[model samples]
Target: MPGKPIVSSNNAICLVGGAPIADDAISAVFTFVNSFVGVDGGADHLLAAGVTPAAVIGDLDSLSDAARATFAQQLNHIPEQSTTDFEKALTRVSAPVVLGVGFTGGRLDHALSVLNVLARYAERAVLLVDAHEVSFLATLGHVAFTAAPGTRISLMPLGQATVTFSGVRWPFAQTRMAPDGFTSPSNEASGGVVTIETDGPVLVTLPRAHLALAMKAAVRAK
Candidate 1:
């Protein structure tokens, strides 16, 4: 169902925010780790799903007394104007790897900001999960993926980092990629394994069906 999460994580945590997060998406947390929190509406969602938050962050603007009470012990009130609560969670996360869901797919502005944040903090091990895709900010290391022969892997540059890809339909050895210059998109996999190696920021998009496998690989990195 839409309310039950499909994947879970131990290396990753989830942030519930102002927008609507699917139940299936919520259940996905079971596949990973158990650490979760309510980011305003996200808290309410947690309670609705019968999941208590490990923490509740944000300005406490949209949070209610009930949601607050539900996550009282886990509540870490972050009253900062400099960044979003979602960012605070990502920033404070000490885990070696973090998988994120419910960060996108609700609003365009927030979705775009998620990308911006991913770019700004490419050094962090993070993956953004959406309804249709799973993306990570391609950083200085090697990102490897194995997709169906017809599956498409596309790259879009973010910030100061450059993208040099290999093992894909389009190849780049050591190339600088920025928002203004050459772009990589609609690239197809060559059957075995598809690897994208870069030193900066690039958005790696793949179908939702591949997210489970992709996340597993990302967390397995050295």
Candidate 2:
């Protein structure tokens, strides 16, 4: 189970995971949120970047000796093996939105696990960002945004859902979507406003250029 809050903030917070973080990706995140929460080994990344997280939460298994010693006071260790460090830190932080970095662009299984956590905690406004794209679980079951013509817009269901779309080259309405059944990938936006509505959770992904808009839409979803 997720433990109590370790860091709560009115402004949005950023959770750094154990995956390798690119310099440009780290720079992108700083444009939005300053408050940071390092999950286990992620503390080492933050320390190297010269930013100390307000708190660090995880099982402490992957945390490095340097990070452990540097952020000893900030550590909030949860020794349970049931959850990943990303899930542990994500659930313990309270904010209007969470921008997750260092959670992708790594091992395939680890990247997939991050998506699982996003789907499991769909109620929270979280955006998993990486080098190329930004992904978020549309918990409110709907989202609207504007993108340039031919821009890539992908909607993937972690479970099952009936989804509808507009302002896309291949629009679908109330069509059942799921991991094994059907998925929308490489869909192109037709320019101007794009609207998507779903009856259940759907993961929406767009180019990293639209990160600001994605964050705004996510915060307004619920």
Candidate 3:
């Protein structure tokens, strides 16, 4: 008898819509969730990544005729006039978290739109993972991390953030990033856990490679 086929599971979904996705971006996605979103052009990114999208949610404007044809039969085809396709996809997926690449980095307007979605989906635990950084619409909690001794971590404030950290090159205790906050860029890890205390949504980003490794570890643990 033939052996059974191997089946791998993926909860970490990647969205490659249209934001100039990085070459290494696909490595982070255990599963690719296609969103034929308009404005962001995420549908194009989906096909380019060679991933058979588990779900393609979006309006029809962003997708090219050929792209639409490619996914014609598979599309979930949400025609809601109010929600963006990206938002539509996020609503449909039941995953614990999402790593949304190609959702940033193209047009400035599109990038801003992605941010709006993040804020709206803040309660969804969706992390908008992009080439340059990972953004989250945090509500109330602490974000912590432990990486190899010398990894660099950067925090850019979106909304006001009351931040604190240790085990970093530059440690700040109860620091606030206000309307005009410090850059706090290029801080290195100190082989221990770094914590950020915040009451609202703040954009935190680190090296994508480290996050990819961590996500892989998470899958293995599960």
Candidate 4:
């Protein structure tokens, strides 16, 4: 079961995770989301950057001694082994959108776990940002955005999905996608505007440069 919200906000909230995060990539996130929550050891990252998170939610397995001491009042420990720290924090946060960093770029298994959480919480508008890409759940069933010609757009289905696309180099319609079957990867925008519509859970990924547009599409989908 999902936990009750420990932090709620009208604006987007950024969740910092324990995985490695690029300095520039993490900095860019702060521009879009001023409010922040730390997922366990994520609080250590924020402290290093000299930013204080509103709350720290996780199992505290990876939390650093300094972070625990510094954010003593903000600490929120949920000692559950059923879910990853990312899911623990994500479920406890309420916001218009959730921007996550440091959830990728570490162990491949951990990154995959993050994707699983995104699919499980498909109704929530969440974006996972890495050094080179911005990824999110295509919960709206349809998403439209502009990108320069040849910009890469990848879609991976979390469940069975039928999809259609336009303004892409290899546009397709009624394409069935599933983890066990075909998945769309490295498709590029031909130019101008690109649109994608899906009937089931799908993950969309784009270049980091298109973060703003990705965020807009996620919010609009919600």
Q: Considering every candidate listed, which one attains the maximal TM-score?
A: 4
Q: Report clash pairs, candidate 3.
A: 17-41, 17-42
lDDT of 2 by residue, 44-144 (tens): 88888888899999988888999999999999988888888898898899899999999997799999898888877777899999889998887565678
The TM-score, computed over Cα atoms with residue i paired to residue i, of candidate 1 is 0.83
What TM-score would candidate 2 get against the native? 0.95
Ranking by lDDT: 4, 2, 1, 3
Model 4 segments beyond 4 Å from truth? Answer: 1-4, 220-222
* Model 4 Cα lDDT, one tens digit per residue, 29-105: 88899688989998988999988999999999899999999999999999989989999998898898999988988
Across 1-222, the per-residue lDDT of candidate 3 in tens digits comes to 013211112345555566677777765554443322222256666667675565566666677776677777656566777876677666666554466767777788877777777755556555566665665543356556577788877666666768776778788887787647664667878887876666655665566666653343222111
For candidate 4, give the lDDT of residue 150: 85
lDDT of each: 0.70, 0.87, 0.60, 0.89
Prediction 2 global C-alpha lDDT: 0.87
Weakest lDDT window of 10 consecutive positions for candidate 4: 213-222
Error of 1 at 151 (Å): 1.7
The positional error of residue 194 in candidate 1, measured at the CA in angstroms, is: 0.8
